[model samples]
Target: MSTPQLLMIEDDARLAQMVGEYLTQSGFGFHHALDGASGLEMLQQRSPDLVILDLMLPDTDGLEVCRRIRAMPSNALAKVSVLMLTAKGDPMDRIIGLEIGADDYLPKPFEPRELLARIRAVLRRRGEGGSDAAPAAVMRFGTLEIDRNARTVTVGGMAADLTSYQFDLLVAMAERAGRVLTRDQIMEAVRGRELEAFDRSIDVHMGRIRAAIEVDAKNPKRILTVRGVGYVFAKQQD
Candidate 1:
């Protein structure tokens, strides 16, 4: 298998250099762009497997960059996994990033080891960074179809746009259809990380997933929320 390539769009040159070295030593091909524009161009040219986007950029904000990536004309590029880097202690920034389609986020001033772990987790959900293998399986519920091999979800034969993390979250819930899972349980199932108190990242991703698969995101039918609980995937859907 080819080495996974990562693009880091960070304006902090020293930090980027250090991270590039660390990731490169850890068996990844690393590339760097000082600003969002150059990073977007590099994304098209290099087609890296994942991107580490910094929230504060010299040219444009990371939120706009993530939006542009999701809006790209090329589906492959648009769907490429994104792991954002946000300011430490800023939950709002992370929430906004996730809402706009980032696969995951790591706060600044973090240990390099934690960053590495987050990257591996994001890629593992996308079925790239892990060595474990499983047979491809397809799950169907009414008009919704989830193809595990292709890592795709479709509704009534039309493809649903979902980020890598969101896709895994949907699969985890679908696998346990009709069972209510708390936000921590859901995040643990997909991300293997405990959620911080008051963290609403799971809610953000769930909203995005509903928007992709539900005919009416406002009144979701496929994934239902249990007040004072978590969420449950409907066993029967149309």
Candidate 2:
């Protein structure tokens, strides 16, 4: 199989070089751009399988770059995945990246091994032969609709802003509507990995998702939490 092509847009010379080297050694084909404008140009000229984008850039803002990339014709970014790389560890920053269409977010000061694992996980989730059938091309439950191709969710016909984790969690549950999924199962399916201690991260994400999709987050109807198990997607039966 051909190596996956990656585009890295980062202004930090030393860090960029180090990351590039790591990715190279991992058998990935990649190119680097030091500024946002050049990165955008490269994106338009040469489509890549994935992008590792930094928030701080010389020419253009990373958020703007993400917006522009998402605005590009589907033919341009149809199969491309974006992983936002930033020094900002703020929860809001992560939320914004996902809202702007990034597929994943990795804060800076991260271990190279973790970065590689995240990249591989994102690719695996998007690639063929996963455990579950690819999330539906379009999944609808009540007024909530999820479009996997568009990577978007809408509630009552209005677009709902969701973090990447929140979107993944909702999709995981919605795909298997009416089934109760344990917390561990939910984490495994959505995160593509096992959970560790202090993994209440999933609970936080689930809360956010419920707020976005549930008419009443305090008393959610769709995402029901079972007493001893995890949660369930209670789609009303006809």
Candidate 3:
């Protein structure tokens, strides 16, 4: 297999060098850009398997880069995963990153090991190790369709424009439709890992999913809360 290609877009020279060295040692072919413009240029020239994007770049912001990437032709963006990195840890910042089409987000001042783990996890979830026949592509659930291969979603025959995390959460629920999945279960399925103590990221992702797919997010019918247990995807009638 070819080495996984990674594009790192970070303004911090020291941090970039450290990350590049780590990824190189991990058997990845990596490239770096000091600013968003150069990063975008690199992306257009040769798409990478994954992108490590920094939110606060000297030129265009990472969020804009994500948006531009998403707006690219589906064929171009397909199979390219994006992991956003930033110092901003606010819930809104995370949400915006995801909303703009990042496959994952990590706050700054993070350990290189954690970053490596996240990259591996995202690739695994995207079905990097599986055979070609494995269903790593689109999954349909009623009027809601999730194109995992493309990282896009559609609701009631229209584009839903959901965040990457929201799409993953919805896909998880759809995969086990009509079955109650606990918070831990959902987190494991969508994030490919367990959450730390007091982490409500799952809830946030679920709420965003509900907002996209449910007619009334306040009284969600598609994703029903099962009291103390967790939640379930209410069976849709034919």
Candidate 4:
């Protein structure tokens, strides 16, 4: 396997330098962009395996940058792994980041080792930062179709826009069909990690999925919540 390439978009020159050097020594190929605009330009040009994006950038907002990447029509660019760096302690920022398709994040003034660990975790969750594995099989339910091999989903024969994480969550639930999975189970299956206390991240992602899959997101029929329990995929499709 080739070394994973990483792009870091940070306006703090000194901090970026230190972190870049550290990540390089830690076995990743590093590219540094000083602001969001240049970073996004580099993103289009290089398409790194993962991005280390700081929330505050000189030319643009970090959140907007993430949104732009996730909005790309190209599957490869839209699904690229992102690990956010922010100085804010607000949980809202983290929630927003995840909602915008960031794979993970670390609040600023963090240890470089922790950043390294997060990078690895995000990459692992993104199927070792790259996957050429054969798609398992096709799953069909009414107008909804999931092509595991292609990692594509379509509703009514039209392609549905979904982030990589959203797709994983949908597949995990759809595979189980009638099972009512707890939060821990769902998190474990999709993220390979347990849910944290007071972590509503799963719910946020679930809403995103519903909007993409359900004809009426306000009255979702596919993935239904089980009150105190987690959620369940409808076994019987109309």
TM-score for each model: 0.97, 0.69, 0.79, 0.90
Measured by TM-score, how close is model 2 to the native structure? 0.69
Q: Write candidate 2's Cα lDDT for 29-83 as tens digits.
A: 8899999888978987778878899987888778888888877765447447788
**Every model: Cα RMSD to truth:** 1.2, 4.8, 3.4, 2.1
Question: lDDT tens string, model 1, 32-59?
Answer: 9999999999999999999999999988
Which regions of candidate 3 are displaced past 4 Å?
129-141, 145-168, 211-220, 227-229
lDDT winner, 3 or 4: 4
Model 3, residue 125: distance off in Å is: 1.0
Worst 10 residues of 4 by lDDT: 125-134
- Residue 187, candidate 4: C-alpha displacement in angstroms: 1.1
Ranking by TM-score: 1, 4, 3, 2
Among all windows of ten consecutive residues in candidate 1, which has the lowest summed lDDT?
Answer: 188-197
Deviation of model 3 at 42, angstroms = 1.0
- Alpha-carbon runs more than 4 Å astray in model 4: 130-135, 193-195
The worst-scoring run of ten residues by lDDT in candidate 3 lies at 126-135
Error of 3 at 11 (Å): 0.6
Give candidate 1's TM-score.
0.97
- Give me the overall lDDT of model 3: 0.78
Global lDDT scores for all candidate models: 0.91, 0.77, 0.78, 0.86
Tens digit of lDDT per residue, candidate 4, span 207-237? Answer: 8899888999889999999999999999777
- Clash totals in order: 0, 0, 0, 1
